[model samples]
Target: MEYMRTVGRWRRVVRRVAAVAAVLVPLAVVSVVTAGPAQATGCRTNAHVYLTSVYPSSYRFENQPVDGGTDDYQMFAGDSTSFQVGGNGLRPYTSPAWRVESNVSGSFVFNGRVAGGNCVANETTVGLARHTVAGEVWTVRANYLTGNSGQFIQNQAHFRIFFVDPPPPEPWYWQPCYYAEACF
Candidate 1:
Protein backbone atom coordinates (compact mmCIF):
# COMPACT_ATOMS: atom_id res chain seq x y z
CA MET A 1 0.00 0.00 0.00
CA GLU A 2 1.07 3.65 -0.52
CA TYR A 3 0.95 4.32 3.23
CA MET A 4 3.46 1.53 3.96
CA ARG A 5 5.92 2.91 1.38
CA THR A 6 5.81 6.36 2.96
CA VAL A 7 6.63 4.94 6.41
CA GLY A 8 9.55 2.92 5.01
CA ARG A 9 11.10 6.03 3.35
CA TRP A 10 10.90 8.07 6.55
CA ARG A 11 12.62 5.28 8.54
CA ARG A 12 15.49 5.12 6.02
CA VAL A 13 16.01 8.90 6.20
CA VAL A 14 16.02 8.81 10.01
CA ARG A 15 18.63 6.03 10.09
CA ARG A 16 20.96 7.97 7.76
CA VAL A 17 20.76 11.11 9.91
CA ALA A 18 21.44 9.07 13.04
CA ALA A 19 24.54 7.50 11.54
CA VAL A 20 25.96 10.89 10.48
CA ALA A 21 25.30 12.38 13.89
CA ALA A 22 27.03 9.48 15.64
CA VAL A 23 30.24 10.12 13.71
CA LEU A 24 30.21 13.92 13.90
CA VAL A 25 29.34 14.33 17.58
CA PRO A 26 32.33 12.34 18.80
CA LEU A 27 34.65 14.16 16.38
CA ALA A 28 33.57 17.52 17.70
CA VAL A 29 33.98 16.36 21.29
CA VAL A 30 37.53 15.13 20.62
CA SER A 31 38.51 18.46 19.11
CA VAL A 32 37.30 20.35 22.15
CA VAL A 33 39.02 17.98 24.57
CA THR A 34 42.38 18.33 22.84
CA ALA A 35 42.05 22.10 22.55
CA GLY A 36 41.91 22.68 26.30
CA PRO A 37 44.87 24.44 27.93
CA ALA A 38 47.91 22.32 28.80
CA GLN A 39 48.48 21.65 32.48
CA ALA A 40 51.64 23.16 34.03
CA THR A 41 54.40 20.65 34.78
CA GLY A 42 56.68 20.78 37.84
CA CYS A 43 59.63 21.00 35.43
CA ARG A 44 58.78 24.69 34.86
CA THR A 45 60.07 25.62 38.32
CA ASN A 46 63.04 28.01 38.56
CA ALA A 47 66.25 25.98 38.11
CA HIS A 48 69.52 27.34 36.69
CA VAL A 49 73.34 26.95 36.62
CA TYR A 50 76.08 29.22 35.23
CA LEU A 51 79.46 28.20 33.80
CA THR A 52 81.23 31.42 34.93
CA SER A 53 84.31 29.90 33.26
CA VAL A 54 85.44 27.29 30.77
CA TYR A 55 88.22 24.81 31.56
CA PRO A 56 89.31 22.77 28.56
CA SER A 57 92.13 20.29 29.01
CA SER A 58 94.56 18.90 26.43
CA TYR A 59 91.97 16.69 24.77
CA ARG A 60 89.66 19.70 24.53
CA PHE A 61 91.63 22.83 23.50
CA GLU A 62 95.29 23.72 23.40
CA ASN A 63 95.35 27.36 24.51
CA GLN A 64 92.02 29.17 24.69
CA PRO A 65 91.03 31.80 27.20
CA VAL A 66 87.61 31.69 28.83
CA ASP A 67 87.38 35.49 28.67
CA GLY A 68 85.78 37.81 26.07
CA GLY A 69 85.27 34.88 23.65
CA THR A 70 81.92 33.24 22.91
CA ASP A 71 80.69 30.34 25.11
CA ASP A 72 77.39 28.53 24.50
CA TYR A 73 75.39 26.60 27.11
CA GLN A 74 71.87 25.83 28.43
CA MET A 75 70.60 24.40 31.73
CA PHE A 76 67.14 23.27 32.87
CA ALA A 77 66.05 21.79 36.21
CA GLY A 78 63.11 19.38 36.21
CA ASP A 79 61.24 19.24 39.48
CA SER A 80 63.83 18.64 42.25
CA THR A 81 64.78 15.21 41.01
CA SER A 82 66.12 15.73 37.48
CA PHE A 83 67.99 18.26 35.32
CA GLN A 84 69.15 18.84 31.75
CA VAL A 85 72.14 20.68 30.27
CA GLY A 86 73.13 21.31 26.65
CA GLY A 87 75.12 23.85 24.64
CA ASN A 88 77.90 24.36 22.12
CA GLY A 89 81.28 26.11 22.31
CA LEU A 90 83.64 27.41 19.63
CA ARG A 91 87.18 28.36 20.80
CA PRO A 92 88.88 28.93 17.47
CA TYR A 93 91.92 26.79 16.61
CA THR A 94 92.75 25.80 20.16
CA SER A 95 89.56 23.89 20.86
CA PRO A 96 87.11 21.71 18.95
CA ALA A 97 84.00 23.31 17.42
CA TRP A 98 81.39 22.10 19.94
CA ARG A 99 80.58 19.73 22.82
CA VAL A 100 77.42 18.84 24.81
CA GLU A 101 76.33 16.81 27.87
CA SER A 102 73.44 16.29 30.33
CA ASN A 103 72.81 14.67 33.75
CA VAL A 104 69.63 13.56 35.57
CA SER A 105 69.56 12.72 39.30
CA GLY A 106 65.94 11.67 39.75
CA SER A 107 63.53 8.82 39.11
CA PHE A 108 63.74 9.32 35.33
CA VAL A 109 67.33 9.14 34.10
CA PHE A 110 68.15 10.72 30.73
CA ASN A 111 71.21 11.24 28.53
CA GLY A 112 71.66 12.63 25.01
CA ARG A 113 74.18 13.54 22.34
CA VAL A 114 75.12 16.81 20.62
CA ALA A 115 73.92 16.17 17.10
CA GLY A 116 72.28 18.19 14.30
CA GLY A 117 73.53 21.55 15.64
CA ASN A 118 72.28 21.08 19.23
CA CYS A 119 68.57 21.56 18.47
CA VAL A 120 67.18 18.05 18.58
CA ALA A 121 66.89 16.12 21.89
CA ASN A 122 66.16 12.41 21.72
CA GLU A 123 64.52 11.01 24.81
CA THR A 124 66.48 7.84 25.67
CA THR A 125 65.13 7.90 29.22
CA VAL A 126 65.23 5.10 31.78
CA GLY A 127 63.63 4.68 35.17
CA LEU A 128 65.64 5.07 38.38
CA ALA A 129 65.17 5.80 42.07
CA ARG A 130 64.05 9.43 42.42
CA HIS A 131 66.17 11.57 44.74
CA THR A 132 65.36 15.16 45.65
CA VAL A 133 67.90 17.97 45.91
CA ALA A 134 66.18 20.49 48.11
CA GLY A 135 65.73 24.17 47.20
CA GLU A 136 65.30 25.73 43.77
CA VAL A 137 68.96 26.68 43.11
CA TRP A 138 72.22 24.86 42.38
CA THR A 139 75.46 25.08 40.31
CA VAL A 140 77.96 22.76 38.64
CA ARG A 141 81.48 22.90 37.25
CA ALA A 142 80.77 21.89 33.62
CA ASN A 143 83.86 20.82 31.74
CA TYR A 144 84.64 19.82 28.17
CA LEU A 145 86.84 16.78 27.67
CA THR A 146 88.34 15.69 24.37
CA GLY A 147 89.98 12.29 23.93
CA ASN A 148 91.58 11.42 27.28
CA SER A 149 93.04 14.88 27.83
CA GLY A 150 91.65 18.34 28.59
CA GLN A 151 92.44 21.28 26.28
CA PHE A 152 92.41 25.06 26.54
CA ILE A 153 92.89 28.07 24.26
CA GLN A 154 95.47 30.87 24.63
CA ASN A 155 93.27 32.98 26.89
CA GLN A 156 90.60 32.18 29.49
CA ALA A 157 86.89 32.88 28.87
CA HIS A 158 84.40 33.76 31.59
CA PHE A 159 80.83 32.61 30.96
CA ARG A 160 77.81 32.58 33.26
CA ILE A 161 74.00 32.10 33.12
CA PHE A 162 71.57 33.04 35.87
CA PHE A 163 68.84 30.62 36.94
CA VAL A 164 65.31 31.56 37.92
CA ASP A 165 62.33 29.61 39.23
CA PRO A 166 59.42 30.38 36.97
CA PRO A 167 55.86 30.92 35.98
CA PRO A 168 57.46 32.10 32.68
CA PRO A 169 59.97 30.43 30.36
CA GLU A 170 62.23 32.46 28.06
CA PRO A 171 65.97 33.06 27.49
CA TRP A 172 65.83 36.84 28.01
CA TYR A 173 64.74 36.53 31.64
CA TRP A 174 67.95 34.78 32.81
CA GLN A 175 70.30 36.58 35.17
CA PRO A 176 73.19 38.81 34.10
CA CYS A 177 76.64 37.29 33.56
CA TYR A 178 79.30 37.75 36.20
CA TYR A 179 83.02 36.91 36.26
CA ALA A 180 84.11 33.83 38.18
CA GLU A 181 87.44 32.13 37.43
CA ALA A 182 89.72 31.94 34.38
CA CYS A 183 89.69 28.76 32.23
CA PHE A 184 93.32 27.73 32.20
Candidate 2:
Protein backbone atom coordinates (compact mmCIF):
# COMPACT_ATOMS: atom_id res chain seq x y z
CA MET A 1 0.00 0.00 0.00
CA GLU A 2 2.86 2.41 0.88
CA TYR A 3 4.62 1.57 -2.35
CA MET A 4 1.48 2.38 -4.30
CA ARG A 5 1.14 5.79 -2.66
CA THR A 6 4.82 6.62 -3.34
CA VAL A 7 4.40 5.65 -6.95
CA GLY A 8 1.34 7.86 -7.27
CA ARG A 9 3.25 10.85 -5.81
CA TRP A 10 6.14 10.26 -8.19
CA ARG A 11 3.79 10.18 -11.16
CA ARG A 12 2.19 13.47 -10.12
CA VAL A 13 5.62 15.13 -9.83
CA VAL A 14 6.59 13.85 -13.26
CA ARG A 15 3.35 15.13 -14.74
CA ARG A 16 3.89 18.59 -13.23
CA VAL A 17 7.42 18.80 -14.55
CA ALA A 18 6.31 17.68 -17.99
CA ALA A 19 3.57 20.27 -18.08
CA VAL A 20 5.96 23.06 -17.09
CA ALA A 21 8.48 21.97 -19.66
CA ALA A 22 5.83 21.76 -22.35
CA VAL A 23 4.99 25.39 -21.78
CA LEU A 24 8.56 26.68 -21.31
CA VAL A 25 10.29 24.79 -24.13
CA PRO A 26 7.86 26.03 -26.72
CA LEU A 27 8.03 29.54 -25.34
CA ALA A 28 11.81 29.56 -25.65
CA VAL A 29 11.67 28.25 -29.18
CA VAL A 30 9.07 30.80 -30.17
CA SER A 31 11.13 33.58 -28.69
CA VAL A 32 14.07 32.47 -30.75
CA VAL A 33 12.20 31.82 -33.98
CA THR A 34 10.13 34.97 -33.88
CA ALA A 35 13.11 37.15 -33.13
CA GLY A 36 14.08 38.86 -36.39
CA PRO A 37 17.15 40.67 -37.66
CA ALA A 38 18.70 43.47 -35.68
CA GLN A 39 17.59 46.95 -36.64
CA ALA A 40 19.33 50.31 -36.49
CA THR A 41 18.88 52.12 -33.21
CA GLY A 42 18.50 55.52 -34.78
CA CYS A 43 17.57 56.86 -38.15
CA ARG A 44 20.47 57.62 -40.48
CA THR A 45 19.47 59.20 -43.71
CA ASN A 46 21.48 59.33 -46.96
CA ALA A 47 21.09 61.48 -50.03
CA HIS A 48 21.06 59.83 -53.45
CA VAL A 49 21.30 62.02 -56.53
CA TYR A 50 19.87 60.80 -59.82
CA LEU A 51 20.41 62.46 -63.19
CA THR A 52 18.16 61.97 -66.20
CA SER A 53 17.80 63.74 -69.51
CA VAL A 54 14.41 64.75 -70.89
CA TYR A 55 15.47 64.94 -74.53
CA PRO A 56 16.79 62.02 -76.57
CA SER A 57 20.39 63.18 -76.82
CA SER A 58 23.67 62.02 -75.36
CA TYR A 59 25.85 64.38 -73.34
CA ARG A 60 28.80 64.26 -70.96
CA PHE A 61 27.98 64.82 -67.27
CA GLU A 62 30.36 65.17 -64.34
CA ASN A 63 29.65 64.79 -60.63
CA GLN A 64 31.73 66.50 -58.00
CA PRO A 65 31.77 64.79 -54.62
CA VAL A 66 31.30 66.56 -51.33
CA ASP A 67 34.88 65.71 -50.37
CA GLY A 68 36.35 67.59 -53.32
CA GLY A 69 36.58 64.84 -55.93
CA THR A 70 35.16 64.66 -59.43
CA ASP A 71 33.55 61.76 -61.32
CA ASP A 72 32.53 61.91 -64.96
CA TYR A 73 29.63 59.94 -66.38
CA GLN A 74 28.06 60.02 -69.83
CA MET A 75 24.25 60.14 -69.78
CA PHE A 76 22.22 59.23 -72.85
CA ALA A 77 19.09 61.18 -73.50
CA GLY A 78 16.00 59.87 -71.62
CA ASP A 79 18.19 57.76 -69.34
CA SER A 80 19.17 58.10 -65.68
CA THR A 81 22.13 57.54 -63.37
CA SER A 82 22.42 57.94 -59.59
CA PHE A 83 25.07 58.79 -56.99
CA GLN A 84 25.15 59.51 -53.27
CA VAL A 85 25.43 63.17 -52.44
CA GLY A 86 26.87 63.21 -48.95
CA GLY A 87 29.79 60.82 -48.40
CA ASN A 88 29.23 58.48 -45.46
CA GLY A 89 27.35 60.69 -43.01
CA LEU A 90 24.48 62.63 -44.52
CA ARG A 91 22.91 65.60 -42.78
CA PRO A 92 19.15 65.93 -42.67
CA TYR A 93 17.36 69.00 -44.05
CA THR A 94 20.56 70.12 -45.71
CA SER A 95 20.92 71.00 -49.37
CA PRO A 96 24.31 70.03 -50.74
CA ALA A 97 24.97 71.59 -54.12
CA TRP A 98 26.68 69.36 -56.68
CA ARG A 99 29.04 70.49 -59.38
CA VAL A 100 27.70 69.06 -62.65
CA GLU A 101 29.37 69.87 -65.95
CA SER A 102 28.38 69.00 -69.50
CA ASN A 103 30.05 69.38 -72.88
CA VAL A 104 26.82 70.64 -74.44
CA SER A 105 26.43 74.41 -74.63
CA GLY A 106 23.44 76.74 -74.21
CA SER A 107 21.34 78.58 -71.65
CA PHE A 108 19.28 76.50 -69.22
CA VAL A 109 15.59 77.32 -68.92
CA PHE A 110 13.90 76.21 -65.71
CA ASN A 111 10.30 77.06 -64.70
CA GLY A 112 9.86 79.40 -67.67
CA ARG A 113 13.04 81.43 -67.18
CA VAL A 114 16.69 81.17 -68.12
CA ALA A 115 18.17 79.76 -64.90
CA GLY A 116 21.79 79.70 -65.93
CA GLY A 117 24.23 79.19 -68.77
CA ASN A 118 25.76 75.87 -69.78
CA CYS A 119 28.84 74.51 -68.08
CA VAL A 120 30.70 74.63 -71.35
CA ALA A 121 29.77 78.26 -71.90
CA ASN A 122 30.28 79.72 -68.41
CA GLU A 123 32.45 77.01 -66.77
CA THR A 124 31.11 78.10 -63.37
CA THR A 125 27.54 76.86 -63.44
CA VAL A 126 26.78 74.83 -60.32
CA GLY A 127 23.44 73.09 -60.13
CA LEU A 128 21.55 74.48 -57.16
CA ALA A 129 20.59 71.08 -55.83
CA ARG A 130 17.79 71.04 -53.29
CA HIS A 131 16.38 68.16 -51.23
CA THR A 132 13.12 67.53 -49.36
CA VAL A 133 12.34 64.67 -47.00
CA ALA A 134 9.49 62.61 -48.42
CA GLY A 135 8.70 59.70 -46.08
CA GLU A 136 11.78 57.46 -45.94
CA VAL A 137 13.58 59.16 -48.78
CA TRP A 138 14.88 62.65 -49.47
CA THR A 139 14.01 63.94 -52.92
CA VAL A 140 16.24 66.37 -54.86
CA ARG A 141 15.90 67.85 -58.31
CA ALA A 142 18.02 70.22 -60.44
CA ASN A 143 18.01 71.53 -63.96
CA TYR A 144 21.01 72.03 -66.25
CA LEU A 145 21.85 72.94 -69.81
CA THR A 146 21.77 70.59 -72.80
CA GLY A 147 21.98 70.71 -76.62
CA ASN A 148 24.12 72.88 -78.93
CA SER A 149 22.51 76.21 -79.68
CA GLY A 150 21.72 78.69 -76.91
CA GLN A 151 18.62 79.76 -78.85
CA PHE A 152 16.61 76.54 -78.41
CA ILE A 153 18.29 75.15 -75.26
CA GLN A 154 16.15 74.27 -72.27
CA ASN A 155 16.70 72.47 -69.00
CA GLN A 156 17.73 69.13 -70.49
CA ALA A 157 19.62 67.60 -67.59
CA HIS A 158 17.19 66.79 -64.75
CA PHE A 159 18.64 65.71 -61.41
CA ARG A 160 16.48 63.86 -58.90
CA ILE A 161 17.79 63.43 -55.38
CA PHE A 162 16.48 61.01 -52.78
CA PHE A 163 17.27 60.67 -49.11
CA VAL A 164 17.22 57.06 -47.99
CA ASP A 165 16.39 56.46 -44.35
CA PRO A 166 17.46 53.48 -42.35
CA PRO A 167 14.97 50.80 -41.42
CA PRO A 168 13.12 51.06 -38.14
CA PRO A 169 14.53 49.44 -35.06
CA GLU A 170 13.34 46.11 -33.79
CA PRO A 171 10.61 45.81 -31.17
CA TRP A 172 11.45 46.18 -27.48
CA TYR A 173 10.89 42.57 -26.52
CA TRP A 174 12.83 41.17 -29.49
CA GLN A 175 15.95 43.11 -28.63
CA PRO A 176 16.96 40.89 -25.74
CA CYS A 177 16.47 37.68 -27.73
CA TYR A 178 18.39 39.06 -30.70
CA TYR A 179 21.31 40.52 -28.82
CA ALA A 180 21.64 38.08 -25.93
CA GLU A 181 20.65 34.45 -25.45
CA ALA A 182 19.21 35.15 -22.01
CA CYS A 183 15.64 35.03 -23.25
CA PHE A 184 16.02 31.49 -24.38
Candidate 3:
Protein backbone atom coordinates (compact mmCIF):
# COMPACT_ATOMS: atom_id res chain seq x y z
CA MET A 1 0.00 0.00 0.00
CA GLU A 2 2.83 2.41 0.87
CA TYR A 3 4.58 1.64 -2.44
CA MET A 4 1.41 2.46 -4.37
CA ARG A 5 1.03 5.70 -2.46
CA THR A 6 4.63 6.64 -3.29
CA VAL A 7 4.02 5.90 -6.95
CA GLY A 8 0.95 8.11 -6.88
CA ARG A 9 2.97 10.94 -5.44
CA TRP A 10 5.60 10.51 -8.12
CA ARG A 11 2.97 10.60 -10.84
CA ARG A 12 1.51 13.77 -9.39
CA VAL A 13 4.94 15.38 -9.35
CA VAL A 14 5.50 14.43 -12.95
CA ARG A 15 2.12 15.81 -13.95
CA ARG A 16 2.80 19.08 -12.18
CA VAL A 17 6.17 19.43 -13.87
CA ALA A 18 4.66 18.67 -17.24
CA ALA A 19 1.92 21.24 -16.76
CA VAL A 20 4.40 23.93 -15.76
CA ALA A 21 6.63 23.15 -18.71
CA ALA A 22 3.71 23.26 -21.10
CA VAL A 23 2.75 26.73 -19.91
CA LEU A 24 6.28 28.12 -19.75
CA VAL A 25 7.44 26.78 -23.12
CA PRO A 26 4.80 28.68 -25.06
CA LEU A 27 5.44 31.82 -23.11
CA ALA A 28 9.14 31.58 -23.88
CA VAL A 29 8.37 31.21 -27.58
CA VAL A 30 6.00 34.17 -27.55
CA SER A 31 8.54 36.29 -25.77
CA VAL A 32 11.20 35.43 -28.31
CA VAL A 33 8.93 36.16 -31.29
CA THR A 34 7.70 39.44 -29.81
CA ALA A 35 11.19 40.53 -28.87
CA GLY A 36 12.85 39.98 -32.28
CA PRO A 37 11.33 42.90 -34.22
CA ALA A 38 10.90 45.20 -31.28
CA GLN A 39 14.54 44.91 -30.33
CA ALA A 40 15.31 45.49 -33.99
CA THR A 41 14.02 48.92 -34.94
CA GLY A 42 15.27 52.17 -36.52
CA CYS A 43 17.14 50.57 -39.41
CA ARG A 44 18.74 48.30 -36.78
CA THR A 45 18.40 47.87 -33.07
CA ASN A 46 22.00 46.65 -33.13
CA ALA A 47 23.37 44.99 -36.24
CA HIS A 48 26.03 42.36 -36.01
CA VAL A 49 26.95 43.11 -39.61
CA TYR A 50 25.90 44.97 -42.75
CA LEU A 51 25.32 42.99 -45.91
CA THR A 52 25.77 44.99 -49.08
CA SER A 53 24.25 43.91 -52.33
CA VAL A 54 23.92 45.49 -55.72
CA TYR A 55 20.62 45.58 -53.91
CA PRO A 56 20.24 44.43 -50.29
CA SER A 57 17.08 42.57 -51.19
CA SER A 58 18.55 41.36 -54.43
CA TYR A 59 21.25 39.11 -52.91
CA ARG A 60 20.72 37.29 -49.66
CA PHE A 61 22.19 33.97 -48.51
CA GLU A 62 22.20 31.55 -45.55
CA ASN A 63 25.26 30.10 -43.81
CA GLN A 64 26.10 27.93 -40.81
CA PRO A 65 29.03 26.84 -38.68
CA VAL A 66 31.34 24.41 -40.39
CA ASP A 67 32.20 22.47 -37.26
CA GLY A 68 28.66 22.88 -35.90
CA GLY A 69 30.14 21.81 -32.61
CA THR A 70 32.18 24.85 -31.54
CA ASP A 71 33.97 26.14 -34.61
CA ASP A 72 33.27 28.89 -37.17
CA TYR A 73 29.70 29.75 -38.20
CA GLN A 74 27.58 32.28 -40.08
CA MET A 75 24.76 34.55 -38.92
CA PHE A 76 21.12 34.85 -39.98
CA ALA A 77 18.05 36.47 -38.53
CA GLY A 78 15.47 34.53 -36.46
CA ASP A 79 17.99 31.72 -35.93
CA SER A 80 18.66 29.94 -32.67
CA THR A 81 22.23 29.30 -31.57
CA SER A 82 23.14 25.73 -30.77
CA PHE A 83 26.33 23.81 -30.16
CA GLN A 84 25.49 21.29 -32.85
CA VAL A 85 24.88 22.03 -36.54
CA GLY A 86 21.61 20.13 -36.46
CA GLY A 87 20.43 22.22 -33.55
CA ASN A 88 20.90 25.49 -35.52
CA GLY A 89 18.03 26.90 -37.60
CA LEU A 90 17.32 29.63 -40.13
CA ARG A 91 14.46 31.58 -41.74
CA PRO A 92 14.36 32.82 -45.31
CA TYR A 93 15.94 36.19 -45.86
CA THR A 94 13.33 38.88 -46.42
CA SER A 95 13.96 42.29 -48.00
CA PRO A 96 14.02 45.27 -45.73
CA ALA A 97 13.45 42.95 -42.79
CA TRP A 98 15.68 44.84 -40.34
CA ARG A 99 16.98 48.17 -41.49
CA VAL A 100 19.06 51.02 -40.19
CA GLU A 101 19.51 54.41 -41.90
CA SER A 102 22.19 53.96 -44.53
CA ASN A 103 23.25 55.91 -47.56
CA VAL A 104 23.95 52.66 -49.31
CA SER A 105 20.70 51.66 -50.97
CA GLY A 106 21.52 47.98 -51.16
CA SER A 107 22.83 47.67 -47.63
CA PHE A 108 21.03 45.73 -44.88
CA VAL A 109 21.77 44.71 -41.31
CA PHE A 110 21.65 41.33 -39.48
CA ASN A 111 21.86 40.20 -35.88
CA GLY A 112 21.18 37.22 -33.66
CA ARG A 113 17.47 36.39 -33.26
CA VAL A 114 16.99 35.70 -29.56
CA ALA A 115 19.16 38.09 -27.57
CA GLY A 116 21.01 41.39 -27.98
CA GLY A 117 23.01 41.80 -31.13
CA ASN A 118 26.55 40.49 -30.72
CA CYS A 119 28.96 41.56 -33.49
CA VAL A 120 28.53 44.82 -35.39
CA ALA A 121 30.25 45.34 -38.72
CA ASN A 122 30.25 48.57 -40.71
CA GLU A 123 31.61 49.09 -44.22
CA THR A 124 31.47 45.34 -44.76
CA THR A 125 30.12 43.85 -47.98
CA VAL A 126 27.92 40.77 -47.98
CA GLY A 127 30.17 37.93 -49.02
CA LEU A 128 30.47 34.34 -47.88
CA ALA A 129 31.85 34.40 -44.37
CA ARG A 130 31.99 32.39 -41.16
CA HIS A 131 32.00 33.81 -37.62
CA THR A 132 32.73 32.38 -34.22
CA VAL A 133 31.20 32.62 -30.75
CA ALA A 134 34.45 34.14 -29.53
CA GLY A 135 33.57 37.40 -31.41
CA GLU A 136 35.73 36.62 -34.44
CA VAL A 137 34.27 37.35 -37.92
CA TRP A 138 35.36 36.65 -41.48
CA THR A 139 33.78 36.42 -44.95
CA VAL A 140 34.16 33.82 -47.66
CA ARG A 141 33.31 34.29 -51.31
CA ALA A 142 34.19 30.76 -52.40
CA ASN A 143 33.29 27.24 -51.29
CA TYR A 144 29.84 28.23 -50.11
CA LEU A 145 27.34 25.63 -48.88
CA THR A 146 24.89 24.57 -51.57
CA GLY A 147 21.77 22.72 -50.48
CA ASN A 148 20.66 22.50 -54.12
CA SER A 149 23.16 19.68 -54.56
CA GLY A 150 23.94 16.47 -52.61
CA GLN A 151 20.66 16.92 -50.66
CA PHE A 152 22.47 15.94 -47.44
CA ILE A 153 20.90 14.30 -44.39
CA GLN A 154 17.43 15.59 -43.59
CA ASN A 155 14.56 14.23 -41.53
CA GLN A 156 11.04 14.57 -42.94
CA ALA A 157 8.28 12.26 -41.77
CA HIS A 158 5.85 11.15 -44.44
CA PHE A 159 3.32 9.42 -42.19
CA ARG A 160 6.23 8.28 -40.04
CA ILE A 161 7.90 6.25 -42.79
CA PHE A 162 10.56 9.00 -42.96
CA PHE A 163 12.28 10.18 -46.14
CA VAL A 164 15.97 10.95 -46.59
CA ASP A 165 18.48 11.40 -49.36
CA PRO A 166 19.54 8.26 -51.18
CA PRO A 167 22.57 6.65 -49.56
CA PRO A 168 24.82 6.61 -52.64
CA PRO A 169 24.35 10.08 -54.18
CA GLU A 170 23.84 11.72 -50.77
CA PRO A 171 23.59 15.37 -51.87
CA TRP A 172 23.96 18.19 -49.31
CA TYR A 173 20.49 19.61 -48.90
CA TRP A 174 19.34 20.34 -45.35
CA GLN A 175 15.68 21.35 -45.54
CA PRO A 176 13.92 18.99 -43.21
CA CYS A 177 12.77 19.02 -39.58
CA TYR A 178 13.14 22.79 -39.67
CA TYR A 179 9.82 24.47 -40.31
CA ALA A 180 10.13 23.63 -44.03
CA GLU A 181 13.24 25.77 -44.08
CA ALA A 182 17.01 25.13 -44.09
CA CYS A 183 19.08 24.27 -41.05
CA PHE A 184 22.85 24.03 -40.98
TM-score of each: 0.23, 0.26, 0.25
43-116, model 3: which lDDT tens digit per residue? 22211112233222112223333222211223331212121101111211211123222222233333322221
Estimate, for each residue in 92-175, the C-alpha lDDT of model 2 and write its tens digit: 222323333332321222221222221122112233333323232212223332222112212223342232444567766634
- TM-score for model 3? 0.25
RMSD of 3: 25.5
Model 3's lDDT to the true fold? Answer: 0.30
- C-alpha positional error of residue 129 in candidate 3 after TM-score superposition, expressed in Å: 37
For residue 50, give model 1's deviation from the true position in Å: 10
Compose the digit string of candidate 1's lDDT tens values, residues 35-134. Answer: 6533211122121112222243111122343444444433333333322333233211121222221232311122333322222222222222333232
Residue pairs in clash, model 2: 138-163, 140-161
* Every candidate's lDDT: 0.34, 0.33, 0.30
Tell me, by TM-score, which candidate is best.
Answer: 2
Name the candidate, 2 or 3, with the larger TM-score value.
2
Measured on C-alpha atoms, candidate 2 has an lDDT of 0.33
